[model samples]
Target chain A: MLEGLLVDLVPYGKAFQDLDHRWMNSEASFWSSGGERHFMSEAMVAARHAQWAEERERTGGGSGVGFGVQTKDGKPLGYFGINWLAPAHRLAMLGAKIGEPEYWGGGYGTDALLLLLDYTFDWLDVRKAWLMTTSMNARVMRQMEKVGFRLEVRQRQSALADGVWYDWLAYGLLRDEWAGRATLVEQLGLRERAAALGSGAK
Target chain B: MIEGTLVDLVPFEDDFATYLETWMNEEAWFRAHLWERREPHTEHDVKKFIERMEKDERGALIGFQAKSGDPIGALIFDHEWPRVRKAEARFFAGDSRYEGCDEVLDALLMLVRYCFETRNLHRLDAVALPFDEAKLDHLRRAGFVHEGTLRRHIRWDGDYVDMEMFGLLESEWPGYAAKVAELGLQPSGLEPKPKPEKKDEKKDGTG
Candidate 1:
C-alpha cells in the first residue's frame, strides 16, 4: 500500500473491479486515443479482473505490483502499476489510468504518480522506469516531464490512432536523476518514507 | 538464399548449429558486441535456440562465404510489428576479417534489399552502444539515420551503457541506393558510370 496526499495505491482487489471495468470501457479514459475506448462485455471485464487478481496474488509485492488508486476516504479513482518488472536490471515499465472522469485535471493524478514513483525508486529498488504515449497526448506528456521523466525517443509515425499517424514518445527516468531532484521530491511528502528506506534499499 | 558479391544469406538451417555455436562462443567478440551474459555453448543449446526461433517465426539467416561456403555471420530480424510492417535487425559478424571490410557492407546491402524491396517492410531499426563508433559508422554508411539515444539502456560489464538508435525507412532507400552507386560502393557487375574527364586550365598563366 502507498499513501499520498490525495490518493492511496492499493493492491488489486474485488472492490476495484467495478471502477476498472468502467475505466476500461469508457471513451474518455486515458486510453481513448489509443483506440481502446469501446465498452467491453461484463464477462470480459470480469475475466480480466480475475486474471489480474491472480497475478496480484502471485507477484504483487515481489516482481510486479498493480495498484488501485483511491482517495483517502477510499473512493476509487483509477488503476496504476509497474509491469514487465526486471528486478535483475532494476528496470520497469510504468502504466496508469485515472478512470473517474470527475477526477480529471485534479491534482489526484499527479499525487498518485508521485506516490508510485516513490515506491518504485525507494522501496522497489528500481533504477529505471519508462513509459510510452502517443504524440497527440500533450497533457500526459507535460505531466510526465513535470514529474522528472526525460524524453528518450520520438518513434516517428509509430502509432496510427483514429486514422491519423502519431509518433510514439518514449520517456525514461533513472534512479540517480530522481535522486538528484531531492528538494522537489521532498515536497511530495515522500522524504520521510524514502529516508526510512535508507541507502541499502537500492 | 540472397546472394551478394562476397557472401550469401541462406535461411538458417539446423545443420549450421555448430558454426553458430563457434561464432557465439568467441569471448572477445561477444564481450565487445553483445549486451547479454555469455553462457556456456553446446550443441543442445544451439538446437533449442534454433527451435525457438523457428517456433516464433523469426527471420533468421546465416551469411556464408560465397566461395568457401563457410558461415561468416548471422542476420536476425526480431521485434516484428506486422501491423506497422517494421522490425528490428541484429547483425553479428563471426569472421573478424569481415568486421570493417566491404564484405560486411555487401551482407548488409543484401539484407536491406531483401527487407525493403522483397519483404516490403516499412522500416528497419538497429541499435548500437554510444562507444561503438565502428558500428555507428557502418549504420550511417548503410543509410540509417540517427533516431535518438536510449539513456542507460543496457548493463554492460557491470555498468550501464547508452544505446544509440538508428532507423531506415523504405522511402529513403532509393536515395541511399543512388548515393551508393555514385560513390562506387555498389557491387561489381552493375555497369559503372563513366568518369568525367578533368579539365586542366592555367590558374596563374602556368599551364
Candidate 2:
C-alpha cells in the first residue's frame, strides 16, 4: 500500500470491488463521467473490473495502474489511478474519485492525488502526468491548478451535460514542476490535516 | 465509393494494402502519420493490420484514390457511435504529392459531410504532430478549430513533440461549408460513383 497523510493507496480487494456499483452510480459518477450521469449494474462493474485486470496482466501493468483509496483506519473513501500510460513518451493520464460525498472538499481526493503522482513520477518514472475534466467541474479545475498542473488545452463545447455544453479542459504536469508531497501538502494548507492524521495514527 | 472532383473514397483493397506496406516503411511518411514507435512492419504485419481494420466495428478505414485511380492515402473514423456521438478522424497521404493539396481537402470535406450528415455524429476530433505543418494547414482549411495542444505528448524519432488537437461540431458544418465554397472548394456531389466494371473485367480476362 502506498502511504499518504490522509489516505493510503491500497490494492483493490473483494471488499472494495463490492462498492464499485454504488460509487459508479452515485453523484460522484457525474464528476467522473464529466457531467454525464449514468447507472451501472453490479454485473457491469464486475465485468469492467475483470477487463481491467485482464488488460493489466496482458500488458504487465505497463499500460495503467489503479488503486483503492483508504483512510488510516482502513475505510475506503474511493479509487484513483493512471487511466493510461505512454511509456515511449513517459506520460500518463490520471483519474481519481472520492466516492463518499462526506469526503468531498475535504482534501481526501487531494491527498490521494498527491500519492498517485508520487507513484507515477518516482516509481513509474513518468515525465508528465495529465488529465481531462469538464469546465463545469470547478472543484477539479481548482484542484488541478493548486496541484501545479497547467491548463494545456480547452476544447470548447466538447461535452454536453444536463442540456448545457461545457468545455473539456486538459491539464498537464511535468515531473520537474511538481513540488514534492511535503511541499505541496504545506502549500495547499493541508499540513495541519496531515499533522492531525499523523498524530491520530499514533 | 464517395466520389469528389479530384479524389474518390474507395474501399480497402489489396492495391491500397500494397501501397500501405510501402508507406509504412518510409520513415518520414510513417512518423508524420502516427504516434506509435517507429518500427518496420513486415508483409504479414500489414495483412494483420488490414484484417484488424476490417474487423473493427467502431471504426471505418477508407482509401482515397486520385481521379487517375491511383491510391494516394486513407482516412479513418473511430467512435463508439450512438453511445458517444463524437468521432476521431485520422488521415494520411501516402503519396507526398497530394500532401496539403486540393485533393486532400476535397477528401476531408467529403469525410466531414459523411460524418455529420449520413452518420449523424455530433462532433469530430483530430490530432496532428508539431512538425506536420501540411496536415495542420489541411485541418484548418477543412474547418477544424484548433482546440488545444498537449505538450510533449508524442514521441517522434527519439524526442518528444507536442500534439495539436482540433474539433468540429455538427452545427458548425454548414457555416464551414459555405466558407470553403467561397474559397472555391466544392463539398457537394458526394454520391457514390458507379465503378466501371468493364475495366476490371478486361483486366481479369487478360491476366
Best prediction by TM-score: 2
Which segments of model 1 are wrong by more than 4 Å?
A17-22, A25-63, A179-202, B27-38, B58-68, B175-183, B186-207
Docking class of 1: acceptable
Q: After superposition, how far is residue B164 of candidate 2 from its true place, in Å?
A: 1.3
Candidate 1 clash pair list: none
* Model 2: DockQ vs. true structure: 0.58
Query: Could you tell me every candidate's TM-score relative to the true structure?
Result: 0.78, 0.90
lDDT for A57 (candidate 1): 78
Docking class of 2: medium
List model 2 lDDT by residue over A46-65, tens digit each: 99989888887888874778
Which clashing pairs does model 2 show?
Answer: none
Residues A1-202, model 1: lDDT tens digits: 7776566789767787766667777755535335434567889988976776677678655456778888777888887888668755677888878887777666667777777788888887888888888788776787787788899987776666666767777789998888443455556444454344331111
